[model samples]
Each structure stands twice: as C-alpha cells, then as structure tokens.
Target: MDGQYSHDSRKNILEWSLPVIDEKNKSGSLEFSIDGKPNDFFPVHVSFVSKRNFCDIQVAKVTYIEGGSPVRFSSETSFVVDKYEIL
Candidate 1:
C-alpha cells in the first residue's frame, strides 16, 4: 500500500473502490489501462486472508502528467472475476 495520504498527495492522486464479496468473489485481481496510455497501467489485487484482515479498499487510477492532467479513457480489454472463497 502507498503511504498514508499527505496533504499534497491528496491533490493529485485519485482513488476508486468496489465491494468484494467473500462467497461471490473473495480474492482476485483486475488489470486496467489509464487514459489509453500503453506505458501507464497497473493491476488491482484483492484478497481475503481472515476476518481480522477485513479492510477498506481504495484504487489509484491516475496521476497528473508532468504538465498535463489525467483523463479517463476506455479500457482496452476486460478482466473476468472468477476467484472467490467460501465463508
């Protein structure tokens, strides 16, 4: 995880979240493309270790370029959610 939000960091980084269900889809990962940039991409990993491990999730999707702003783009492809753990 990235460091706790500093005052300046909050102004640049954007975060998104989705609920993960244990019985439905407990653990998995998603690959996403940002602003249609090939070089700029990342993965979101999700897992359920234990009840004690329950936590909120925040996904950083984009960042401001050197002298430009980050824009939202269509995903080049899609990911299937198939991994899950039964409670």
Candidate 2:
C-alpha cells in the first residue's frame, strides 16, 4: 500500500483500495447480483490482525484524483464487524 496515499510524517492515516469483484467470483461481491435476486453467496469468512490501527477513526473527507489532477469518483466507507473479543 506504499505510495498509494500521500505521505505525511506528522499525521496518522491509512489508505486502502478494494478490488473490483465481478460475477465471475464466489466471495467479496455481496453488493452485486447474480441472477436478478440479491446475491447471497458468501461461502467463506475472513479475519485478520494488523499493526496498523486498533481504534476506529472517522474520515475527514475524500478526494478523487487521476493523472495528478482532481477527478470524479464514488466511494462508500463502513466498519463491519460481527464480533471482537480480547480473552
């Protein structure tokens, strides 16, 4: 994820780019449809631990850029977690 977002030594931030899933997939495409009906084909679960950040933070704003120039783009951000325990 290096060089994906602007660098700042005095600020704490993270940047991520989700992959584009399609009908030719079996996971990570819950927001898309398969056969007119809401696609509910999640055959797996994913979880992980990282050293990036523990507490969730609110985003200030979003900017879309292309070829070093401002551009138009749409994005959605959410924090989805079923459960997390420290034991």
Candidate 3:
C-alpha cells in the first residue's frame, strides 16, 4: 500500500493516509499493536468511507438498449454496523 505519515509531538497530532490500500477488489485483514495499554487510547476518533449506508436505499436499472427492456433492481437490506460508540 502507498502511504504518507507525519506527526507533531508538540501538538499531539498524527496524520496517516493510505492511497492504494487495495486495488485488486478483495477483502483482507490488517493487524497492528500499540505499545501502551488499551485504556490509554480511550475515546479515539476514527473514520472511513463506505458505499453502503443503513439509512439510505440504493437501486439499479439495467437495459438492453436506450430504455428498452428495462429491468429494475433494489437491494433487500438490513441493519448493519456490528459496533457503535459515541465519545
């Protein structure tokens, strides 16, 4: 993966970005560890991009030609998100 890392100890700031995490379109796992105890990192702020959202519905339409033999498809969705935290 391509990444950029920078940190500022005076401001307690860490910037990390991975531009090319996965280009092959396959699910994978990443594991890492911190030196300190887990409780020391309480109230961490994390964010990521997602295509599917629980509050929104998505639909797709397919056609053989310009609006000819049109077929519509809608996803049968359910509640997601295994864990949620507010801090």
Local accuracy of candidate 2 as per-residue lDDT tens digits, 5-30: 33243642222223432345323312
Candidate lDDT scores, in order, read 0.42, 0.38, 0.55
Provide the lowest-lDDT 10-residue window in model 3.
Answer: 25-34
All models, RMSD in angstroms: 21.8, 19.5, 8.8
Better of 2 and 3 by lDDT: 3
What is the model-wide C-alpha lDDT for candidate 3? Answer: 0.55
Residue by residue across 37-87, what tens digits does model 1's lDDT show? Answer: 533333433442332233433344665678567766543333344675422
TM-score of candidate 2 relative to the true fold: 0.20
TM-score, per-candidate, Cα-based: 0.22, 0.20, 0.33
lDDT of 1 at 76: 34
Winning model by lDDT:
3
Cα error of candidate 1 at position 85, Å: 16
User: Measured by TM-score, how close is model 3 to the native structure?
Assistant: 0.33
Residue pairs with colliding backbones in model 2 are none
Candidate 2 stretches greater than 4 Å from native: 1-67, 82-87
Poorest stretch of ten by lDDT in candidate 2: 25-34
